[model samples]
Target: MRAFHNTVLRFAACIAMMLLASFVPAAALAQEKTSALMTPELLEKVRRANNECFACHSEEGVKKPPRADLDITKLRPLAHDPKVFNGSNHGLMECTQCHGQGYTEFPHAADARESISACEECHAAKVLRIEKQLDASVHATRVKDKFTCSTCHDPHVDLIASTLIDPRKIVAQDNQHCLDCHDSELEFAKFAPDDEQTSTKKKRPDIDKIHEWLPNTRVHWQAVRCVECHTPATKTLSHEIVNKEKAERQCLTCHSASSSLTTRLYRHLAKEEQERLGFANSVILASSYVLGATRHPWLDRLIVGAFAAMLLGLLIHGLARIVARIVRRKKNHG
Candidate 1:
């Protein structure tokens, strides 16, 4: 019996060791990949170079330009928060790397502006994927040549949404990109001009009035991203922005057990939740309370058990009362 128990213990120990061995490599590989992307030494070098550029291109720097005659609007495009840039995915890159060595001068050369590298230059693979999706989008089809990557994404401050853990933060950032164009009349006119001279120009719709049909519009806006409805429901993090006419209008798209949010707004969290909690829609419960959707299997079981117990207690109480009443009647008769 002792020998048999010892053998079982050894087998369990081997299984535990194998599991630990498997996990260690995976964790190490992830760490290795992150370090390969940007080491501390490289990050420091990038920051130093970026700080020098920011000395002249930052908000305060842009206000007091080398040339007083320089239009603030022209300088505004160059202005960006240094702290925000450092926190972004592109934080490891130097300014001159994209803008060219011409910017090394006190006042950048006029020709240097033309040398600024396109987003496609560095992000070739990503751009290729986005281009395919963009080709099918309303922006590309309607605006044609006028619309580009920078139209929605401000490269200076843009962060990779998938890497972010917080769903609310991701929604806030992504929605802001949409609102920047849709909400502002000046920005809206850029793509959809309402000029009477150009009869072909698209008229801007009243954004708030259009969304009046949605219940608790403010809550919906805060909790979910615009892309949840605007983009294709079939794809995850799809760039294909659909027209208002084709946009999702059904409330059940989100307010259900199998919510479309699992594939859209909360996609980053959904996969993690599935791995951690064995529930994909668990992401929704963590972030926001979606009616008819936030149900957990264990929680539902507990609720049912409680209700059953309550009914059983009521039945017992009723039986005891009837028994006592019969005894009292018997005593009275005696």
Candidate 2:
């Protein structure tokens, strides 16, 4: 009997171990893979190389060209804020990994430019998904070849908004991408030029005048991303941008109790809060107070209960006053 009990316990332990091993690999595979960090020795070498590159590539350095003979018009602005890059998703990477080792020496080799990596080279999975989305976007239909990732995203300083904690910060970062093209006439004309037959010079529509119908436009701009209205309401973090005419304009779409913001702008926050607190719209309540949108069941019940108690108290006081008046009248008559 003792031997049989020990055998049963051992079998159960083996079953538990097998189940854990099966689930562990599935969980690991679900997470996105990042670039491996360099060894300490290699990291120190990369740091020294980055410092040398930054000497000429920094914001102040870009203002003064290294060679007077070089054509200024041909040189693209390579200036970037090191502090911003350090806080970005690509912060751990070595500059040479993207720019090439030839940059270590002045006057880079003719083939060094060819060595520069494309976003898709390292981010095959993510870029593949974005490519599909871009294919369906209005920009793709209008400017077939001109629209690329860098058109909206500045690789040097772009931070993943989903990783951020503050919703306002995410809104600002995402909106800046849209505003960079839509708000700037020069940028807009690159892809969305006016009809040459009608107008000699390209002119972008006034963004403020276009959005005059929206109430508190400045507040809405600060609180939500442009994509919240531009993209399909069904998609979360969608890159398929709709045209201005097709953009969402209904106030109830975002201002109602069942606001689409929960699935769109605040999707990440809602998902996080749902996992942690079991409340879907708690994120909006915690972040910003939106009228008609930030409703809580518990708070609603409390308000209704208070109103009912007040009405009941008023009715009781009226009845007591009538009974006291009758008693006084009866006593005086007797």
The most accurate candidate by TM-score is 1
RMSD, model 2, all Cα superposed? 12.6
Worst 10 residues of 1 by lDDT: 25-34
lDDT of 2 by residue, 1-334 (tens): 8535544554454444334333432222223212233356754664576666666677655677665654444444776666666555454455765675446566778777765656665565778887877898888876768877888887666656555557787788889998888899878877774465985545777888998998888998989888888887665577889888888888888877788888877776666555224333667867777777776666678899999999999999999999999999999999
C-alpha positional error of residue 288 in candidate 1 after TM-score superposition, expressed in Å: 0.5
The TM-score of candidate 2 is: 0.72
lDDT of 1 by residue, 1-334 (tens): 8535544554454444334333432223221212343456765776788787876678977877656665678678778898777655454456765676457786678787766667766566778998988999988877867888888887777765554557787778888998997898788888884455777667677878889988998899899989888887776577899977888898898988888888787776665665225443777778788986776667778899999999999999999999999999999999
lDDT of 2: 0.69
Colliding residue pairs in candidate 1? none
Backbone clashes counted, model 1: 0
What is the C-alpha local distance difference test score of each model? 0.72, 0.69
